[model samples]
Target chain A: MSRTRVLVVGAVLVIFFVAGGILIYVNGHQGGQNLTFNVTVTGATTMKPDTLPAHQNDTVTVNITSDTDGEVHLHEYDIAFDTRAGQMVSHTFKADKTCSCDIEWESTGHPLGTLVVSP
Target chain B: MTLAAQILLHGFGPRYDLPIATALYLYAAGGVVFISFVLVVLFAGDRVGPNATEYPRRAVSWLVPIARSPWPRIVGGTVGLIGFLTVVVAGFFGSTNAFYNPAEYVVWIYFWALMVILSGLLGNLWYLFSPWTAIYDALARVVRIEPVWKLPDVGVWPATAAYFSFACLELTTGMANRPAIVAIAAIVYTVITLAGMFLFGREEWLEHCEAFTILFGIVARFGPLETDRDEGGKISAVYVRPWGVGLLKPAPSGWDRVLFVILMLSTLAFDGISATPAWQDFTVALKGYWLPLGAFGLFAVRTFGLILLTVAFLLIFITFMEAVIYLGQRKVDLKATVSSFALTLVPIALVYNAAHNFSYVVVSSQYLIPLLNDPLQKGWHLWPAVASFTPNFALAQASTVWYADIVLIVLGHVIAVFLSHLRAGERFRTAQRALLSQYPMLLLMVLYTMTSLWILAQPITRES
Candidate 1:
């Protein structure tokens, strides 16, 4: 085989490996069932409980209704569900086993809550 | 604005143990030193010569023959390929989740390890094994394409620009998390690769980004690179004859040595700051002041201090290491030194691992409730509350205890650079020149660090 052919083959192989690995990682860590919940944001600009209860494989639906305009994000968690003034932002997350949910509202700087999952 | 503020301060700051922020700052400082070093080397190129001696002479004997063999090269390429595949697949199919999974820690460490190892052991080994590079090389051969229709006669700037662009991506954006971003990046890279192949041909692309090469040369300065020189019959009797090999020789000194010291020190300072707990409380205190001024003040003091300390410590350590290598009549192997230095990163990684897994271990397991309830905080809150206990020892040694690996990585480069630049005349080599050009970028990094610290200072309201 020509040197060029060898190089191309190597490149293709690398691309394939990288793509395959990413697929497996995402699939392996897929959270359990999809969930929908009604979330209401109340009290001093925070996310209230600071935590919630969900099963290891359960899906959560968070319906957030806030009186104020707050930006909600699960920083470092790759989860950011933003809400507007008096508007609601709903998000669904696959709950891992024994995980605590850190729901943060950036606008109010007060709404930091956690969701405790019961195994 | 408030949300942004909060996110910057309490959210990212206290979380991730503030190491990421510190790393970004260090990266910025390295940029500055790099630019300055390059300019200095260019102007003073005449003065620099290969006057330095290499260390661990026997190791070079072993490495040279092995380097000629294709096995180590192939193995290195395979490792890189695996890592690339994992990142691509995960980005595509991973379900959206709230927290960084503890399990994924293994993969993160793997990526970090592989990148460091390749860069440290073989200079620019990634280019040889890089899927991107391979693709570019292959395409060039088939199509006879070249990216640069007109090769600029001027030296280095074009490549430097390309590299800086990529570094910006690595610094500001989280490309790994966003599939769209990653895809776009991949596409852009492909275009650049093909363009380069079409214009400058495959060899140019291979030589373009040299981040790994520069990193290796810097880290293993005292090792094999020093030894693998064509001494050209100057001082051949003292250094070359002693090694019983043609490759081993002493380095000549000039501006390159000065610039090398500067770059090593800058990186070390950044690493030291990351390891230091002193900045944490200081960051908190600075935030109590007015936003803009507080931010600027914080940046000035913290970054300046970090740069100064890193440079001073690196200088001291490098001088000492060189003395030892010289006295022992040892020739340094870049690969071995880097591998040894890489050991330090393990500790830093472990610390981050613990910090990330803390919630899972403490809250979910119900093991640390008693410790959390200690009288230190004056009452028993919850495990999360108790975890905030900042003992002096923990803070003092946080980098060593939690992120020893990062410290080690930084120190490894310091020693490598010091040993490499110890020669009398050959200090202003190409690698040293390249690093000198990056000082401006480092200053920019310092500014960014200060901004981040300022963001951390914003007051958190009890409620929205």
Candidate 2:
């Protein structure tokens, strides 16, 4: 090939690769499902209970149900397990003495919420 | 990407918490030390005399003797090659392992030993011996096969641009991204090299910046410019010389110096403001909009500073060279000039040492560990080594901020010493001596080292 032709071909190939990477990233994110949860704390404590808490070595079953029409993953207390639409998933977390056992929910294109734990 | 975009994106990363008071103190100290050291060197005169010219003459003289005894070369080269390979492997592939491994003493010792051997015996000999520089130079030569494009005759600005751009990358990016940046930098360098070759041919690129040029010049001041001596049994002072000697002289006016100082101050100001909590919050608040503007402002200031510094250095360098040449031609005593410059390096070394070690002093403190451990989860936040040292007092917990403040306090002394040493000369040597006598900071260093060791020995606790 002529030098000009070779240069042109090389430029095109570079652009193609970069464009393809971007496309893949965008599509993957778009295709991922969104999940939402109405997190309410119910425990016997003399405090305004909007957040859940557990003592050291205490196991608490976190009941999660998704209202949205997509799969959502509950990344609670360092655990990443999924919950399907209209289905409730109960996750049990053992609270370590050093860390407060708080639940967090993560999904595509949505804000993340934290379930605060206090001893 | 746009420069603004790049800066804004980079600002999202962690920053070191250095306070205004601490910075001012350190800056003042550094200034004093640097000026004092320069003055001292200036007054000391050339104690070594012409016979003490050790670079090129000794370099050549010792070579034959060393050639006769090859064991030193073999052993040195072997150790160097091994260490280089190990560092490359560890830095690239085994960084996590190296980071986690508590036995960092081995690496430290290896590096210190290598640096000492190279600097002491070779004297900036790493220019020739460094495997990385060697590889870069070789690749640069290889890329000359296709020399189609040419850079404009901007002079020094291109190199200055490259330096500051690399500095930005160093400050912002993780080590992993540096290789890519280096590759891009290498390409730019190769282009410049080739352009120089095309424009000035071989002499411009090789003779001017050649490793042996300064060495030869230093040797020539003592006796000979080259091995070839004259009919009168005297070594010739002039052999080969660089072109355009007139363009590379002292500035015509004092305004140049004033401009340079202003530029430097502005750059430092930008650096200072960027490190402030207000700057961080402004960036975060502006997020998508004002952040880019801030970044652009920083880049502009940084570039301007670098350019001004380069200009100042060039002016000073040219004047010094002219003085040397004039003295050499007249056969006047030139020993004092060389000695003064050599001694000036001491304060510079101290300042650099203190600046580089500041991060270690800050990070290894007793305060940072607890705050880093307090965050739950093994996610992005759990990365203590990454998140812990951030200077954002608002974003970071109180404990981290408190620890950072303490570090700043210690760093202030280092800066003060640096600045004070700058003015140290015969007139002020007594004052400098008095200052030094008052505080034997070496004892503090020893205590700090012991404390660090104790801290490292303690098992990491998850809970504060």
Candidate 3:
């Protein structure tokens, strides 16, 4: 009985390991979707919609209009674009990395919002 | 400065782990519950009394002579001293910009994040290269140093207090990322440590009062390598055992020690929770109440939250310990059982630290490459190749980090359950009593496991 118990436990663990690996691989490699957002920096650093979401491997584009002259810097992916006061600027990049990365005002280092790319 | 340079200096900016998929989270949680049940089914009836504290250790006698030699100490001490001095000097005299300053990266990323993970995986390397001990040992060689005063018998409470203060510095004060503040804190800590050693003996102060010394020592128990001392208190032999087995050794018993262990877990969890949107909302809601104090209000709110979280952890753990004692129907001392069992929970802390900081460490430590080329920010091309190298953010992709986080969390709880069972066996004697006592412990592990995963899945946000 003890020997049988050991075998059963060992088998269960192996099954769990294999299944978990396959599930993670499949979940991670899902196809991407194109996403776009129009973010307005109305106050010195406040973003209209402070949080942007996208799927992993998605093509992400952001159109920005700011009240002040500063650059919008997206962290992790290291994408950046300059915005003049009252002028619209657009930047595009593939969200290949999955992270809830901060979008910040480059000069003041104030966080404007977050761009979350999920798997 | 360029926008890139500004982003680089903003080292304390929001770092959010890619939240794990809900499906994966559910799978991992179910796996934890199922694994605990399987552990009981397989090992529940095995009775091993006092021998439960015993695990196999193989001594490498060939390495003993080399390990005891002065060469390792000299090289390790010199490197440690250089690293410490670099942080202090760069912090004080170097560029105010943290991008070029090595102080912030060395302290926050390298020492706090990286070294902690290394100690958990590779034994107590910190013991070999701790700058404070290295400096003391070097000084002792030149001058005869002895204790002027005996340290009071406080049972690690001083270290606990020191650690709590350090945690506040890292998590609450927001000063760790500033070069001048980091320098001042280092100089002040250095004076306190050296003064303590001058009054009390070196070993006594380190063992009872020094925060990192106690912390790294606890974390190193999960590592595979261990040392055995001779009658004269020198390392006589080096042994290699299985990871997580060193925790089964008889733990030093005290309420202070228990609180220290709980603090380790609570502080780590709090760091993760503080970054979540929910915690951000909670803090923002309470901000109005303390609005009169201005800037200090945010700091006070965070510190209060940290203390409250710690107290909640302690209360919950104690209640669970009582449940275990009551259900076991054995005449066990609550204090003794609680203290011994507290060490078993450390695996969870270790993995949580590693999992939560996985991407942060990977991405942040890369800054060291460029910093190494021009650590003082004088624009000297000391190593041009390294200075021009770009950081590889793609190394920690969201899907990959999520899998790593879930696996680490699950593995940690499984180990915790195993350690708790062994501890219960030591206390309860009979296999049945031991198994019964662990029911409460198993529940606690499952609960903690879910909480860890839940924290990992929360959206990251800055504290208001």
Candidate 4:
């Protein structure tokens, strides 16, 4: 075979391999499920299981109970809601964007944890 | 927590991309890189392409008049000066909040991220509108400026040092988010640069000491534009060439040049690595031992990590260079071979940088839109329509970003492999020897590509 044919065949093989890989991987993550998490905020830190993981398009709800009056700010998504000292507050939204977002205490800007939405 | 610390704890913006899945994508990228190497060896074996001097270039003679006109320089220089002044003034007097401050957006996003991206894709605009160079040129007309002292024959080591420090400031200091700190740092840098230019001479200082000049110039090599010069060192023609072909021109080789290029890759890799959870945990664990140092502990730890990564990169690169030398069994000096081959790796760096900062360039740069009306944020709306402009956060979706990053990273490795094959063909002067010498480099490229993909797979940040 000529050099050009070899090069052309090599190029096609590469495209096929790369495209096949992505298609297969993406096919596995087709649907999303609703996920709810109850989080406790003590002072500036979040309780155990800090990172809340969800999938793309999943409706995620976080119930926050804090000892201090502040707001819970979910970055990237730009969603926030107020939380009173003794009352439970919940924020729910579709995990439309896939990113590892920082959930911070809105008043002090302290990081409470991460909200990872995998695609 | 201080607001600046809070704001900068994760990043300047809230646009962290989803990490690419490593299992399938990493292997796919590696396979592509390997296959590209095989294809190059099979097809391009032993034949050198036209060297830089002999590369085919069709001069656009009509552009000579436009290129020679003084209007471009005058307008470009004025704009540069205005931009520099605006950043300084706004940084010092603008709102304390980084999100509201245009200075933070201009410096970090526009200049740091966007400018580098443009320099790689287009030609280096920094060459045309570098504020410091413009300032020096303007000052030279008013006063009979002359170099007070001669610059020694140091070969870009100062630039390497300057670049290292600049990277540390961008990555480690955590002060970059503070507008006031950015202003102060910009002022300090300007002062140092002006003093260097005045004492050592403008061209000398810019070539040897200025970090961005050297950096943008290097990235511009892979761009499509080319300025051809006559034997008299005057621009004779302007032409456009294929991207990545300008790298085929034999550039001056030295250890310092090699390290500068290596740092281009290592610093970009370090940016991705530093944001990973493993790095965060390691720093936290080390903080206990450094408690006596107070707030300086984290800063010290980060600086140490940056230096460690740079050194580690240098050593790994040298080992590969040795492998090439041994495999080829050529009488070439290791240092020369290393230096020459270093330029071939630039495509990888450029693409990695583009991929890593894709979200910042697309999404974060939009913050400048609203700021255009009230740059200082005192309710002075220069453009009322812009005042209501909201950044489109979804412009860069996580899936889109992940796929773009993977494709760009793989493409960059392929380009690098092709360039190295050409370089080997030229250097070894025999097809068999050139093909043999490339095994180590091909392996190195595959490994580096995998590492790049792996970094993308890791979470952007996980606060242990």
Q: Specify the highest-DockQ model's number.
A: 3
Chain B TM-score against the true chain B, each candidate: 0.44, 0.36, 0.96, 0.93
Question: Over the true interface residues, superposed, what is the Cα RMSD of model 4?
Answer: 4.7
Residues B1-464 of candidate 2: C-alpha lDDT, one tens digit per residue? 00111222111111122221233333333433443343333323221222222222223554444434545444554554554554444333331322221112122222322342223222333333433334434555676634343444433333333434443543333221232233344345545554554555443433333222222222122222123346884433323221111111121223322232222222223333343344455445545652365647544443444455446544553355344334233332233332333222222222222232233233322223333432222242454564554322232221233233333323332333222222222212244342332122222222222222222122211100
Per-residue error for B234 in candidate 2, Å, reads: 18
Instruction: Give per-residue CA lDDT, model 1, range B272-351, as digits (tens).
Output: 33323454555556655524664365445444454455456445434543443343333555333322322222222222
Instruction: Rate residue A112 of model 4 by lDDT.
Output: 79
Q: Tell me, what's the RMSD of every candidate? A: 18.6, 20.3, 2.5, 2.9
Residue pairs with backbone overlap in model 3? none
lDDT of 1 at B174: 26
Question: In model 4, where do residues sit more than 4 Å from their true spots?
Answer: A1-10, A13-25, A28-33, B1-11, B40-44, B49-55, B462-464
lDDT of 4 at B384: 87
Model 2 local distance difference test score: 0.32
Predicted model with the maximum lDDT: 3
Candidate 1's clash total is 102
Q: On DockQ, who's better, 3 or 4?
A: 3
DockQ of each: 0.04, 0.02, 0.49, 0.39
Sorted by TM-score (best first), the order is: 3, 4, 1, 2
Tens digits of per-residue lDDT, candidate 2, A3-113, equal 554354345434533543343334222211222233432121111233443333345566655544342233223465465555666666554322212232333312223
- Give the residue spans of candidate 1 off by over 4 A: A1-119, B1-56, B59-66, B71-75, B78-114, B121-124, B137-150, B173-176, B209-464
> Native-contact recovery for every candidate?
0.04, 0.00, 0.54, 0.31
User: How much lDDT does each candidate structure score?
Assistant: 0.38, 0.32, 0.82, 0.77
